[model samples]
Target: MNSVRRHALTGFAGLALVYLLLPIAVVILFSFNDPVGRFNYTWAGFTLDHWLNPLAVPGLGEAMRASIEIAFLSSLTATLLGTPIALALVRYAFRGRGTTNLFIFLPLTTPEVVLGASLLTLFLNLGVSTGFWTIVLAHIMFNVSFVVVTVRARLVGFDRHLEEAAMDLGANGWTTFTRVTLPLIAPGILAGALLAFALSIDDFVITLFTAGAQTTFPLWVYGASRIGVPPE
Candidate 1:
């Protein structure tokens, strides 16, 4: 009976995972297939043309470049800003720390439309230009929580002994952090940054709201869909 139950659970889990990943598999597969139309994919044979043919879609290259730049900048910014907050949450006890942590994660749990609108309003009030800069900032704001949460998990396993040893040897906090703590947690930070980058690059709703005159990849894809897609 136990063996049967175990097999049943495993089967269910496997099916669920496959169901989730099917769309992603289709996207990756379709991204390679360059065809003659959009609705019905004509097999012009398998080619990497869509991925490589920058000028094929006209402005596709520019959109890709913008998305990459924004993703990189925002992820890096989020990592820098999030690490300290994560460290503080992990290592220090402070009043309102729980509240701070809650706020950090609140944006992630909030509706994307609401957060995007709020960011738009904030940018408008500040008279900030809402192009690349606004997109970067908006991405960072939404993605920082992911970095903090990911890094803080790593922080739990971290040994503060190295930091303390550096301090004992007369190193200042900044130096100790730079020389000791930062290096140890670098992997977690990097992973978190990659995750943030993925989120930023794939985002459409928030980017749409915040980007006044800029086009990220998702935005470009969306707009292009509206006008009409050319070859697949």
Candidate 2:
């Protein structure tokens, strides 16, 4: 009976994996298809043209460049703001620590639409125009929480003795931080940075609200879908 149950669970897991991967599989399969018309939804014939010249689609290259730039800038800003907060929360004791954590986590739990709308209201109230800078601010605001959490997770299991020993050995705060602390928490920083970049690049709802005249890759793709996404 136990063996049979185990087999059943394994079969279910396999089905779940296939269900999650089916769309990705379809996308990969259709990338090779050369549709005769604008809509590439229906497979016409297989060709290497799309793969060879990805920029064949008008405005795709520009949209992609915009996404890359925003992702990099937002991720960098989040990392810079969040790393110190994570280190402070984990390594030091302070007043209103619980409150700080709650505020940091609030954005993660808030609906994307709600967050976007709130930011829009905020910018309008402050008389700040919505554009590239507004989008950058919004992305950084949402991403900082994730960066803090990811970096904090890595710091949880870290050994404090190493930092203490370095300090005791006549190493100044700057030297210890640069030589020991930064290197030890490097993995968490990297993970947080990558996560921020991915979220910033793929974000649509927030970008929709915050971006006034600028169009990112996801926004361009969404608009193109109404007509028919150009095969590239």
Q: Give the whole-model CA lDDT for all candidates, comma-separated.
A: 0.87, 0.94
Give the worst 10-residue stretch by lDDT in candidate 2: 223-232
Clashing pairs in 2: none
- Candidate 2 lDDT over 1-232, as tens digits, reads 9999999999999999999999989988888988877787998988888888888678888888888999999999999999999999998999999999999999999999999999999999999999888999999999999999999999998998998999999999999999998999999999999999999999999999999988899999999999887666
Local lDDT at 95 for model 1: 100
- In model 1, what is the error at residue 115, expressed in angstroms? 0.8
Cα lDDT of model 1 by residue, 6-45, tens digit: 9999999999999999988876676666666554234456
Clash counts for the predictions, in order: 0, 0
Worst 10 residues of 1 by lDDT: 35-44
Q: How far is candidate 1 from the true structure (C-alpha RMSD, Å)?
A: 3.2
RMSD of each: 3.2, 2.1
TM-score of 1: 0.81
Off by over 4 Å in 2: 1-16
